[model samples]
Target: MPKIALHNRDGSSNGTVDLDDAVFDVAVNVPAMHQVVTAQLAAARSGTSKTKSRGEVRGGGKKPWRQKGTGRARQGSIRSPQWSGGGIAHGPSGEQNHVKRVNKKLKRVALRSALSDRARSGDVRVVDDLVFEAPRTKDALAFLDALEIGSRRVLVVMAARDQVTGRSFRNLRRVHLLTVDQLNTYDVLVSDVVIFQRAALDHIGKGSRPDLGQRGRRPSAGTRSDDADLGQRGRRPSAGSRSDDADLVLTGREQE
Candidate 1:
C-alpha cells in the first residue's frame, strides 16, 4: 500500500502513513455488509415491547348479572374485554422486549466491511489536518461546504478529538463528528461520505481490528480451554505438622 500524506490547513504535510491492504483492500460486498449491519442494528434494539392479554389486565372480577333469566344477553364480569373500562383483550403493554442477537465476530466484520466499502467508493475524504479558528458552527459549516458535503450526512473521522471541531459540528444535524476510536458500523454505513484527518488514519486503522475466524468462537484471554493450562496445579500440604504438635504436647504433659 502507498503511504498517503496528511496535511494542515495551509496544505502543509502533517505526516505520511501507510494503510494495510487487509484492513482496507477487501472488495465491498454490499449484500453481505447490508445483512451484517442490519443484524447488528436489530440486536441493539431494546425489544421491550409487550401486549396485555385479557387475563393480564386489571378488573373484571365479579359477574355483572345473573347468567340466565335476563331480557338482555347474558352478562359476565363488567371488566370483560368487550365492555367499556374493562380489561383489554389484547392491548400493547410496555413489557415487550425487541432485543435481538448478533454474533460478536459478525459485528466486527460488518464494521470493517463498511470501512472498506467507503474507501472503495471514493467517498473517503482525507484531510491532512483540521483547524478551527473559533468554536463556531460556521467554521464547521465552512469545512463541510469546502468538502462539498452540504445537505448530506457526513462522518467526520478525527485521530483523537478536536473539541473545537466537535463543538462546532454539534448542532448540525447533517454532520456527525466521530473520533477515529469511536467509529462504528451504523454511522459509517449511514453516512454519504467519510471525512477523516490524515493523521487520524492510523488511529482509525488501529481501532479497526477485524473479527477473524468463526462468528461465535472469538478466542480471548478470559476464555477457558481444554488444551491450555491456565494456572498452577493444586499441591498437598506437609504431612508431619500434626505429629510434631502431638509430641510437643506429650512432652509438656510429662514435665508437668
Candidate 2:
C-alpha cells in the first residue's frame, strides 16, 4: 500500500495514513491519463458556435439582375453563396456535440493512474483537517504558504463541505478547490501538487490494484532521448548500426 503523512496547518507531520492502493498505487498509464483529461475538457465545451447560412442572411430574397445581359451575370437570390453578405458554407449548426464517452471502469482506472503518477513523484500531500473559524482568504493563503504551495499550482481536495474554504481558495489564481466527489483525472494530472483532506480518502473508491507495485521507473537508456532532437522516429540507433541523423532524414525523404 502507498502511504503518506498527514500534516498540520503549520506543515508539521501529524501522523501517517495508508492510501487505498487501488487509488494511489497503480502503475501510471500515460495514454489513459491523456485521453481522460482530453475527454473531461471536451465535455466542458458548449459547442454553441453558430453561423447564418446563405439562405439565412438578410436581404437575399430577390434576384439582383436578370439573365441575358445588362452587363451582368444571371442571378437567383442575391443571398446566394457566391455573393457578398452570404451565409456560411459548411459552418457550425449550434448543435455540435463535444462530449466524449469514457466508460466508468476506464475512468476509474485513469483516475488511479493519474493519482499514482503524482504519488510516485511524491507530490500528493495529506492534511489532517482544514476547518476555518470563518471564511477568510488570508487564512487560506497563509495555510498554503505554510505548506510551501502558495506560489505553486495546487489542487485541494476536501471531503466534507466547507463553503468558506471554497470561497477563500476559489479566488486564489493558482489554487483549485475541489470536493472529493468533484475530483477527476484531469485535475489530478494537471496540478503541480495535490492536497487531500484525511477524510477525502473515504470518497476515493476502494478498488486497489495490487499487481502494479513500485513505479516511476525510467525506460531503457537505449530508448531515452529528447524527442525534439529526433522527432517520432523511435529510439536512437545502436552503436554498431549507427548512421547520421541526416542520413536517416534522407532515408525518410526517399521513402516518401
Query: Best lDDT goes to which candidate?
Result: 2
lDDT of each: 0.54, 0.62
User: How far out, in Å, is residue 238 in model 2?
Assistant: 45
The stretch of ten residues in a row with the least summed lDDT in candidate 2 is 243-252
TM for candidate 1 is 0.63
Q: What TM-score, over all chains together, does every model reach?
A: 0.63, 0.72
Query: How accurate locally is residue 185 in candidate 2, as Cα lDDT from 0 to 100?
Result: 70
Give per-residue CA lDDT, model 2, range 1-256, as digits (tens): 7778889987898988887665677778888767766766665556788998987888877777777779777888877777777878889999998767765555656667878788889989999888777778789888988788747778787764566676666556577665555556766666789998877664453321112122111222234323211211232122111111111111111221
Decoy 2 TM-score against native: 0.72
Give the clash total for candidate 2.
Answer: 3
Cα error, residue 113 of model 2, in Å, equals 1.2
* Per-residue lDDT value at 5 in model 2: 83
